[model samples]
Target: MNAPYLLPAMLALAVGTYALRWTGPAMRHRMRLSPRMIHLLDTGALILLAALVATTALPAGTDHLGLALPTGVAVGGVLAWRRVPLLIAILAAAATTALLRLLGVQ
Candidate 1:
């Protein structure tokens, strides 16, 4: 493997990721989004999050289901529905997942 190339590649990827993230707020400040645009952006973000979750939960060629995805989703849903604090929601999700794994549920 080209070890020397790895650092530069990783740095480039990181910088690109940062640029993409910053593009949103930078553009937002310069150009206010319309209500429709805002709604579209919100939906897009949710879709991206769902895709990320799905990818993590169900990796390619995996036959077994994992508890992490379902537990995270459940916790997130509960938090949203109950209007729970963000920190508590995160902790609850992490703890629940850990406990489930410890008990060998998945």
Candidate 2:
């Protein structure tokens, strides 16, 4: 937290982050991932995404899970699955959540 060290530390982190971001595209051509590895990576990404959605839709450490958030998320998911426009789906989800909250659904 010292003033003198803060800038240098930030610069180091910035450079390191940029290098990591650059390395992926830089090495993509040379990296030969096996089919199984590629499949695992794809599956892992989906699992991670689902986990993120679940956590956000139903927050942790709450006394009880509320209906509004999960219902809104389900609405969004269904719309997305049905190939609805992303913006419309997101707005619909937000609207659903707000409406449910306003109606005292908690």
Candidate 3:
């Protein structure tokens, strides 16, 4: 938590994250992705994104579910159902989250 240590820690984290992201692309030429491998990678990415959303919106040791879960659900539903624009999907999720929070659903 020290100021000096913070920079090093952040740098390491960034590098590690970058490496993980680059792993698939880096191996693209060397490896062919089987259907199962492709599915697994896609699932892994979605799970990681869900975890990030949960952490940011729900946090830890909190009873409130907040706007994250519902927003993610809405966005997923829209993506699955229709060929909507990315911006529209994002806006819909944000709007839904705001409405849910305003209604005291958390």
Candidate 4:
């Protein structure tokens, strides 16, 4: 009977996320770094991406993670790693997720 602030909270989150994303490219050219530092930075970026992917692809729960999302991500990752087209990889992941969900998987 008291769910009033959800929309605002979500909008704020969206704004904050976009702000950080936008600043990345805007500040990218302004920053100066050594070649070694640049390589390390690139590695760090990839690590961040991996972490994001993991968190999203794994279903979150209070007690345990679910199997469906992770399975979909695994399929997608392999396809991507094998140099499959991006659209195909994404569609495969989506389809896997949908199928699992349709089967009432947690």
Kindly list the per-residue Cα lDDT of model 4 for residues 33-99, writing each as its tens digit: 8999989988896676577667777646757767888888878877866678979988998899889
Tell me the tens digit of each residue's lDDT in model 1 across 1-106: 4999999999999999999999988897688779999899888966765675556545677687787657765675466446688678778777777888888877
Report clash pairs, candidate 4: none
RMSD to the true structure for each prediction, in A, is 4.0, 3.5, 5.2, 5.7
TM-score of each: 0.58, 0.69, 0.49, 0.48
Tens-place lDDT per residue, model 2, 1-106, is 9999999999999999999999999999999999999999988966765676677788878987889988888787667656689799889888999999999997
TM-score of 1: 0.58
- Of the candidates shown, which would achieve the greatest lDDT relative to the real structure? 2
lDDT of 2 at 21: 100
Which model is ahead, 2 or 4, in terms of TM-score?
Answer: 2
Task: Tell me the whole-model lDDT of each prediction, alpha carbons only.
Answer: 0.74, 0.85, 0.70, 0.82
Worst 10 residues of 4 by lDDT: 56-65
Model 2's alpha-carbon lDDT is: 0.85
Residue pairs with colliding backbones in model 1 are: none
Number of clashing pairs per prediction, in order: 0, 0, 0, 0
Model 4, residue 18: C-alpha shift (Å): 1.1
Residue 37 alpha-carbon offset, candidate 3, angstroms: 3.6
